[model samples]
Target: MTEKNAYQQAGVDIKAGEQAVELMKDAVADTYTPNVLDGIGGFGAAYALGSNYKNPVLVSGADGVGTKLLLAIAADKHNTIGQDLVAMVANDILAQGAKPAFILDYLAVDKMRPEVVAEIVTGVAKAAKASGMALIGGESAELPGLYAKNHYDLAAFAVGVAEREQLLDPNNVAVGDVLIGLPSSGIHSNGYSLVRQVLGITTSERFKDLPIAMQETLLTPTKLYAQAVWPLVEQGFVQSMAHITGGGLTENLPRAYAKTLSAKINWGSWPILPIFNELQAAGDLSLEDMLLTFNNGLGMVLVVKSEDTQKVISQLSQTNQAAYIIGEMVNGQESGVVFEGDAPW
Candidate 1:
């Protein structure tokens, strides 16, 4: 009798793993710039920073797609979430005024399926290219005992570089600075647990009958701000920026402010997407809770001198990014952020 391999009996398919690598190789290579020094299938990815700076600071961020992955798996849509992974980390690094250089992903699944893995990596490669970040390498693990079949999770590490003098510092944010709001794609990758609950996603009937538009809204990928905002950062146009993720504007905007300063957001100044309005009505959520949980409609908040607000807005408009003067920084009381006028909800 032939001896059986314990690893195969445990359900890890080595052949499937090899197939995944072969399928993803071309997609990953497409994201490479001259900086990437090694091909795929290496034990470690290699990149040459080259001699490009007076003072270089490597900025890195690690983040996952959060519960948004659940929805992706539920909907059988695997592609866009990889972009969500890249956007979450790349945008965070961009907050520090860094240009993303490369990214690595971590994908763990209950079972290895080459097609599914390839689809996921294809999306990662797409977003990496779009953000000008090289998709240098990543890991795909198959753990049969840990997750149920068809269940998986994704996380990513993004590395960026900035000149030491050019790194954004919230300490530089001061009173009288204007706050510019950048439009979000939709709900993005945050508050989906509440989103699922609010929308009654667990019920099969509810899931099947979800409004077509609403379904699309819920799955919209996070916006990648690096390509759009990096030029502004390089030009010293942005003093500070907050990427609105899980915390919404109420929490995120303040991250870019000095302690002595508070953000005064004009609640009705920008358009609140219909999806947010729907969530509020469905969940009966108060405006405060909504602002604290979801992004509402703005995905990013940029702090700039009052005099330069128009210039910044105009430049963003040229790039087809709709931006609005959503608020201003003022002497603080106790809260870091304060809203003005009636709540949009």
Candidate 2:
């Protein structure tokens, strides 16, 4: 009997990795945009944002869906996580008033399952298309000993472009500006680690009894603001926008407020999603945790002048967007989001 070398015995298969890469070549190619200068496998991805817009400011952000991938694995649902990955990065930059131009992804797994890989990548492609960005490229590794079977980690990079004068900066925010909140697709990939810990439940179990519409809500693709808010921004109806993510409104909203101003969120004004109520009930999570962790339904926020608020809300509604006047900027020494009344939870 011949003894195998240490590398082979440990299950590190360079040939298999190469084969996996070869197998995904075509699907990868489908994601490329016109600005993509080269194919994958280079030391780095080369994208030319080249002379596309006048005085273009490059906005770039990188992020992962975090332990939300654990939920995807537990549910044996690979499709939606990819969209979550794109949202994590794209939305962050979109908060700065830029439009995503191209995206790159990174996938690391114990072993590659072609179907699962395809499902995840397909989500990325679909999301990129929805956001008007091209899924330029990505890397997938088959590391046998590093992860559990059916367990994988996903991340992405999104680059956007905005004119110098068009960028939304916190400095422009002022007192009396109104905050319009957009509804979030349930738990859009943040605070999941805490959620899982507190719920003491599996993703499949947590999602099982939900109505079809609600389950779909969990898997619903992220709401891309590039199209919804960009026109308003270009038309001068917006002061600044906040992309509600990891830190929730308790943290993110204040960042967009001036140091001398704060936001007062009217609890009755915004619609809270059912999933959030379920989480709070299941975990007995305090209001503080709820406000600081979960999105509590609001996703993206647009801070606009009081006079422009009604027009902006009308336009968003006409576009079939669920927009609400959730709060107003007020003069205060501290910058933070203050809930004005009791939440139904």
Candidate 3:
């Protein structure tokens, strides 16, 4: 056998990798814009900034799907995980009022499976397009001993640009500004480490007895808010924004505004989803811990002037998803977050 064949014998198949690229070509092409100067097979992706901004400030973010990948693999679900990978990072940059331009993803697998790779990349392309980004390039590798059989890890890096003069600043958030809560679809993409444990979601079991809605949500991808919130940012309707992730509202909301002020939250203002309540009861977890770990029904929070509250909510309503006036910004050097009403559960 030739050297190329020998490499395949060791489990890394060059021909299979080439096949995977071929399958994903059409999907990747769909996300390209005039700025995507080069296609796949390049050492680096070249995207032109062009004359889009008077002064362009680049914002970049990187994140993985976290332990959520374990559940997807266990259930043999590979599609939506790519979107989750994109959202985990894309939402972070979007929070700072950046317009997404391009993204690159990385996939590492135990074996060379072209079909699986194509499936994942297709999902990535779909999400990137929704976020108005060009999926310029990506990498997929096969390592024999590194990952377990049929297991892989996924991550992505995103870059966006905002006008230097228009970048959102927490300092711009006034004391009377209200917080608008964007409802999440179940857990989105965080706290799976606890969710998997409390619910007995093991590698061998796929929640057959669980309610169909809960079962489907376990692998649901994170929602990309670019479509709904970008217009608000462009119109200067927002002061600051927060993307709820690992630390939930407890940690994320504080970053949306100045450290000198605190957020006065009306706990019963919005309805917490049943998923959170179920997880809380199943794990016997306290409200504090639950709030810290999960998104608690709100995935993204925006700080807007009290006057713009209705306008923002009205605009967001067109998306057909509910947005709520859950809280307000206030003067308090004491704590970053202060709860007023009781949990609606």
**Number of the top candidate by lDDT?**
1
Full-model lDDT, candidate 3: 0.88
lDDT of 3 by residue, 1-345 (tens): 455667888889989999999999999999999999998899999999998679899999989999888877776778899889888888898899998889999999999899999999999999999899999988999999999999999999999999987788989987889999998877988999899889987653656566777777788889998888998999999999999999989899999888888999898777788888888999999878897999988989999999989999998888775899988989975789888876743
Candidate 2 lDDT tens digits, 252-297:
8877767778898888787788778888888888888888898888
- Against the reference, the lDDT scores of all candidates come to 0.89, 0.80, 0.88
Per-model TM values vs. the true structure: 0.96, 0.89, 0.96
Between candidates 1 and 3, the lDDT winner = 1
What value of lDDT does candidate 1 attain over all alpha carbons? 0.89
- How high is the lDDT of residue 100 in model 3? 85
Q: Candidate 2 overall Cα lDDT vs. reference? A: 0.80
What is every candidate's alpha-carbon RMSD to the true fold? Answer: 1.7, 3.0, 1.7
Candidate 1: worst-modelled 10 consecutive residues by lDDT: 203-212
Query: Which ranges of candidate 2 are over 4 A from the true structure?
Result: 1-30, 41-43, 202-221, 333-335
